[model samples]
Target: MSGRTPSTRLADTIGARPVSASAVVYPGKVWDVVSEDVDLGRAGTVTREIIRHPGAVGVLALDDEGRVALVHQYRHPVGMTLWELPAGLLDVEGEPPLLAAQRELAEEADLRAGRWDVLLDWVLSPGGSTEAFRCYLARDLSPVPEADRHQRDGEELDMPTEWFDLDEVHTAVLANRLNSPSLVVGVLAAHASRALGWSTVKPADSPWPEHPKLR
Candidate 1:
């Protein structure tokens, strides 16, 4: 053993290897697929194909009654209408994750939150994609004015909003009834954070250094 204490151990390491060469292989409407030759020091150089994404944000809107807001939206790629937290891609340049979460909450759920906290941050698929994700805990919620609501289209046009008890959602997630990544992580994180008196949550404006845009 290196004699390092368990408390001194960090979860994820933050570092980058040198990329000898890189190029986009497929340019898509939302994201792009790229190939890169990375130098791994003694391990030698290796090539990797990656899906370059703009990252995304999700909002766990908790009402005063402890119900969590959710939306049933069609995900064409998955071929299912998933129950998900209000979420959207970070495609808008220069928009902060918190703002993105707020926008998603209003647009998808027709709700706004007065209190926001960073609940969790994660990478969707570290080995295959550059998709960084952030989930926010939102409280003190209120409905947006009817006239101020965003016009929905495509998969969002017929989306339905619902609220469920946090514990119920957590149980559903563990039972495999819910599969949305954001919903799963958000509910589990919310339960754990609540157990710790919400000390696990960070400020809404906390810096997300791991996000591709920020890095």
Candidate 2:
């Protein structure tokens, strides 16, 4: 047998904490707060309060010219409009994450892509929220006529969107100019993917078991 201990091998495996008991402590419009007692083998049981989320999707739309499409919209939480990639929530009933990404790209940027690849996936805050994110790299883009665009409201109304060189976006990500977790991860991941000739990119329909909504 290998020198790795059983406990170490188990940690390397994909595992789920068996839920001994769970209940919603608070229900809200966007998410619900839930308390759960989980059983962790070899480590006694523990209770945790989780923000049950439906998850979300983001797009890094790249044109053939190597420009990335971005949007400037005000986020009330931060009290500032941020520069971010086209993105949206996965709240639509029965909608898959990839489809949500496509819809968001069109809605937020008035654009679409002929090809798409899964750039990366991540959990926003495992300790607090069950929010998972999938950042897609959209290539060979085209414009959606003004008439075909999704109507906007509030912060998104009259939003300003533009295309920036991927290299510049990558630099912003490194310099913390574009620091939203989704944008940062998406831009850097896209740069790395392109460097590998997209070998690192997974098919648009690739499995995303990390999103709690799926579970």
Candidate 3:
């Protein structure tokens, strides 16, 4: 085949032994047990490992008014109130990332988008565990007629959903009002879309805001 010879690929399953494991410090519905272990390698050597993970999702919902939806929530970890996009943990078994984004939008903000596109995939924290974040951008939006206040995993989230102009959101970020990555990335992506004239395809009655909040 085109004078190319395929070299044989060798595969091996090296045996490993777990010498010891540390007790989990935190346990949750989806992920549990922060742990450290000594894994004895096939070469008769042991390596210490530690892992901690809590997967999550984030969504940027764009409304026809040239505004982006944001949620104001109290984050206990940072001990402060922060504005963020609709997001939550991927707790459902075999739930697709896009589905999770849709669910999170409805659950967190009582909203949905006519068109949803996944824009970026990233790791929330790579230094510790195998937690990943899937960022999404939603355009042509519609709010859910009814909001279900039920907490998915018994986690209490007292947050209010509000819409801000794209410029306002970007300004809020520079002013430290919107500091979350999802919001930042979403706003940027939407702005890029606007720059490329993607917003013009919609109805002319509602035009993209000319003055983006420069912060």
Candidate 4:
């Protein structure tokens, strides 16, 4: 909601054909080419012949000690170590993004938060990918016991978690340590909320005390 929306125009598709069918990427039939006239400058409109993908969710968990939780992992696609907030894809059908954040924290970091609030929900890359990222701020976290932590298979995520003060995390950002955009936005949002003392109270008990935008 911070930036202006893009303008887009779509044209007609004269013909369409299936390119290939795969089990992993496209469980159903996958189309390769299509005849169409599309304008590249617009919003919610595209000339995609293939099936589009759904979006994902991101969580920025803040402890009562005033530190943000970060996860260090190796992204195979990027082929490098990257620091990101605890997050996951909403692979399941019909799952709420904020609730998914709650589940992700418990499973990935062995942490659960007492109060969760939605900070922002926006598309990460609106041009090519159909990925809409929902960012949330979680507070009053409770850690699961060491015996409760379990590592799942098929994930190369060595997410050794750490908590950093806001200033230290901002320093890391300045040094090009953090890469995820959601984390950047989440951290700034959390910092602003904390400064205004908005996130300290439960939303249910004291909803948007002054600002109509927040209400």
Per TM-score, the best of the predicted structures is 1
What is the TM-score (0 to 1) of candidate 4? 0.68
Clashing pairs for predicted structure model 1, backbone only: none
Q: Is candidate 1 or candidate 2 better by lDDT?
A: 1
The candidate that achieves the highest lDDT relative to the unseen native structure = 1
Query: Residue by residue across 48-163, what tens digits does model 4's lDDT show?
Result: 44234455667788887788888887788778777788888776666655667777887777898888777656556544444556677788899977887656555635567888
Which runs in model 4 stand beyond 4 Å of their true positions?
A: 1-51, 146-150, 199-215
Instruction: Please count the clashing residue pairs in each candidate, in the order shown.
Output: 0, 0, 1, 7
Worst 10 residues of 3 by lDDT: 206-215
lDDT of 2: 0.87
Per-residue CA lDDT of model 3 for 3-41, tens digit only, reads 967656553232335656567777766666565565646
lDDT of 1 by residue, 95-114 (tens): 87788889999999999989
Q: What is the lDDT of residue 215 in candidate 3?
A: 8
**Per-residue lDDT of 141-160 in model 2, one digit per residue for the tens?**
88898888888887678678
Candidate 2 pairs with clashing backbones: none
State residue 148's C-alpha deviation in candidate 2, in Å.
1.7
Computed on alpha carbons, the lDDT of every model, listed in order, comes to 0.92, 0.87, 0.66, 0.65
